[model samples]
Target chain A: MTPLLECRSVTKRFGGLAAVDDVSCVVEEGSVTAVIGPNGAGKTTFFNCVSSIYPATSGEVRFEGVDVTRLAPHVVTRLGIARTFQNIRLFRGMSALENVITARHCRTKAGVVASLLRLPSQRREEAESEAIARELLAFVGVAKWADSAAGSLPYGDQRRLEIARALATEPSLLLLDEPAAGMNPRESQDLVELIRRISKRGLTVLLIEHHMKVVMGISTHIVVLDHGVKIADGTPEAVRNDSKVIEAYLGKEDVT
Target chain B: MRDRIVRLLVATLAAFLLALPVASLRGNSSTGFTIVWTPAFVTAAMVLVGGAILFAAVEAQRRGTAFWDARAATDSAVGRRRPCAAQAWTLGVLVATVAALPLLGLPGAWTKLLLETMVFATIAVGLQITIGMAGLLVLGHAAFWAVGAYTFGLLTVHQGWNFWIAFPAAGVAAALTGLVIGLPALRLRGDYLAVVTLGFGEAVRWVIKNEQDVTGGDANLPGNIVPGSFRKPMGALGEWLWQPAAVDGRTFEPGTVQALIDRECYWFALVLLVVCVACVHLLAKSRVGRALFALREDETAAKCMGIDTTRVKLVAFMASALWAGLAGVVPAVHRGSINPEMFDFNTSVLFVAMVVLGGLGSITGSIVGAALLWMLPALLANWFPEVQEYRYLFFGALMAAMMVVRPEGLFGGARRKGAA
Candidate 1:
């Protein structure tokens, strides 16, 4: 099957420093792909390039054979790619349900006049959006806090809510940036199950994770990066034993 | 301790500034036998009251409390949901009181004051859509108001058009102008947007002033906008409601005709206010409203959620300007004239002040703010007409004080803190 997402020679430069240099990768349909690296490994930059948050300095990004390298972030999202931020950027003052319902922006077709008039079709769309948002919030286990402000939720639930919000977009490929970052061990274990369950839902998952256990425990395919360069790519077991992957994590001589 | 001292100093300085006019006028009176004591006592009273507020604010800040938690008080007083039986009862009572006030033999001036407040309340409700809900700070609202008023005034005077026909036409004209400004202005955010909009207001006034033939220049159009009688077919309802009687060479009842017309105008304005409030309230509860709130909270995150931020912002601008446009017709309809001066920067600032004071994003808050501010001057005009002249200065001081003490406004919405 054709890859769901393909990044060819993607490079992002920031004033003399190449944040993501000559990086190329493919996310196959319905597969769980993990991109792991050290602190400055360009994992987030690579994601940014693909999501069109930052246009790649060189190279192309194709989603299901359609070139979307230069598309705006919202346009990219409309093309079935949704992502969570590394810093948990929920609409702070909004309720959890609102945060999720807001993601249905592209899916819902109600305009200002229709909404103002409370047209039957608009009301139906709104009710449906609300129902879907509530279901997603429940799926993430923060359904009880649906009416509470998103920022006021506990840290773990906030992360879950972000995931639920991303899921609300109904994207084909979901990109999670450090989904397990700052999460406790138990939470990370739960996140692993969640990712597995999400992939089982027939959606392709691409995630950047620092928790080795979560990465090794869930990802079907692994690609490693170090200093803006791709160091390894294979199945979890093969990538785990690769010399360069080991060298990238630890010093070369120390690994030897 | 330091904060208290700073507050004390600021309060004293404000008192001095506020008293400067009174003090300067005291000795400058050409007639040396002026009643200076009344002015002096009023100034002192204002200073003392202002000092008390400053001290209280300082105490609240020191105690690490929500210094501006008026939202709780207001929420309790006017319950958020309108459909609640108690709220509905209260609303019915309020509406009845307003409707009956003119018939109760109240002074004509007071009725005029109430009508003015309703007009401003309507305008503020429109402004709340953009500034309060959409998280946009538009300073050119008065320009749209001016455009509507001019359009209405011109069409009525020159073309001999009826009031009903000219009203919607004026609104559309202003909306077109709003589109013209909004397309370019929406690209800039926060202060830049404010500055550009401010420029738009001045630009509009300048254009009107230069277009001497059409707009009548700075002298203003005269009293030609004679309000046409709301005629209905001779039927039982019309006979019962508006029975024409011959008295003192007039077809309608002697003194009651003018009073009835005034009452009719009041009713017309009231209906418009209710419609504006209902529409704005409904819009705020809709999907577009939620999208606006999301965009206001975080543009980038909203974008990642697939919101077209530009389209949203532009829509907000146009909608807001549309309200101002509709409101612009009121003054022309009421006063029967239009002038470039009527749409000054001070008018724009007053609308912003109303939004900020009422609580941004809260519909009732905007209405209350506009009503309170408009009524304040009307009530005080008989006693201190001089104070009415310095309205903008007072508004500026009030806004500054609000920023320090109650930045979230009276009925707090989202804590709008970020500059961008």
Candidate 2:
């Protein structure tokens, strides 16, 4: 099968330094992939380029083999790719359930007129969206926080809420940027298992992580970048043994 | 359990307000300044009682007092609290009391007062779009009103155009002017936009003043709305309009022009009021409305969310300008003259005050706020002329007290249920 997402010869520059320099990679269908690099490694910038959150400097991004490099984030979302931010950008004032339910706008077909008229179709869609929001929040294991303000949740729960919101978009591909960051070791372990479960559900997943263990253990394929250049790509075992991959990890293969 | 006390406080306040005109019977009507003390009693009673209750509520919650039972700090109680039956009852009672306005006092001026309230409400709705939903400060709403008045004045006086077409034409003209103002909004934020719009309002006034040939400068536009319309009172315009209108030879001196204008405007204002309210209701729930709220929350995030911020901003600007345009025509028909002096800095400020005092982002609040501010001055003049000159002083004092006490207008926002 064709890859679910592909970036070819992608390059991003900020005046002098290339944040993502002519890198190319394909996220295979129904697989969990991780992009890992230390600080200033361009992984997040690469993610932004593919996610359409920022315009790519050059190159093409294909979502399920359709070119989508120039689409706006919401349009890109309509093409079945969604993402969670590193710092957890939940709608701060809205409730946990509302944060996820808003993503249902991507799927809603009922117009404002229909909603105002209280049409049966609009009512049905609203009911369905609410149900899905609740179920997704539960899937992320933060269902108890559904009625609370999203901002009022603990940091760990907030991260889970971000994942819940991303999943509510019903994307064919899901991207998580540092979802495990700042979590304690136990929370990180739980996150790894959750990623495994999400992958098993046949949702193609791409993750950007700084933590070595989560990236190395769960990712079906691993890609590494150093100073905007793609230095390594292959199976976790193959990428781990590459000398440049070792160098990109600051020569700490034992830990990586 | 404690709902009854709040209900009782509201009732007592209404009773005092109804009795205010009796106390004002002692004062003469000509002067521009005086404090109507009977209404002052109502304001003071509200302040003292409301302040005490708020203090008690806050203190009780702090000490975990048993009397203030079940007051959870959980936001469900305050932020997203549903409007209950008590709320519905309060609205019903208020409407009924206002319905009795002419019966108790001000018998002849009931329609006039109601029509004026509705006009301000329309202007306030325009402010709600620009300031409440879009989070843009518009201290210059009167500019749009002026734009409408001039459009109607120029068209009707010079071309002898009927109001049916000129009213909507004026609306579109104001919207275009709003679009011009909206261009600079692309670069400004918060108080900066407010100042620029304020300047724009002054510019509109200046243009009207200098163009005496067109605008008649400071002179009122002689509102020559065809006379036979109200005098007949048999057609569609007078259907639901209160009978025995101001010029229906009820109590007015026979054939007085003021009574004629007043009578005709009663019918015209009623029609416009219904249209204005309905139009605002529709606009509030439209696609543009959703986009406006989203932009207000975070412009960058809204853009990232795939909403076109520029398009939404332009819509809000037009929405505001159009309503003010519609409202501007009311004064022309009411007074029969559109003067450049009518659209000044102070009128714009009053419109802003109506929106803020009502509730930013709330249609109901805007209506109530508009009515309160608009009527405060008039009520002082008619009911208590002794307090007429000092009416604004009382208004200022009341507004300040409200800001401290409730801060969220009389009704707060038009509720958006299930919105997170």
Top candidate on lDDT is: 1
* Candidate 1 global TM-score: 0.82
Clashing pairs in 1: none
Predicted model with the maximum TM-score: 1
At residue B110, what lDDT does model 2 achieve?
A: 43
Q: What is the lDDT of residue B30 in candidate 1?
A: 23
DockQ of 1: 0.42
Candidate 1's docking class is: acceptable
State the local distance difference test value for candidate 1: 0.74
Which candidate gets the maximum DockQ versus the true structure? 1
lDDT of 1 by residue, A140-255 (tens): 78999887668778988999999999999999999999999998999999989888888888899999999999998989999898989998988999998998988878868643
Residues forming the 10-long window of minimal summed lDDT in candidate 2 chain B: B69-78
Error of 1 at B65 (Å): 17
The residue ranges of model 2 lying beyond 4 angstroms of the native Cα positions read A109-124, A251-256, B1-93, B107-118, B151-203, B210-214, B222-290, B357-359, B364-420
**Candidate 1 local lDDT, B85-156, one digit each (tens):** 444454555465566655544334445556777878888988887888777898988898888888877776
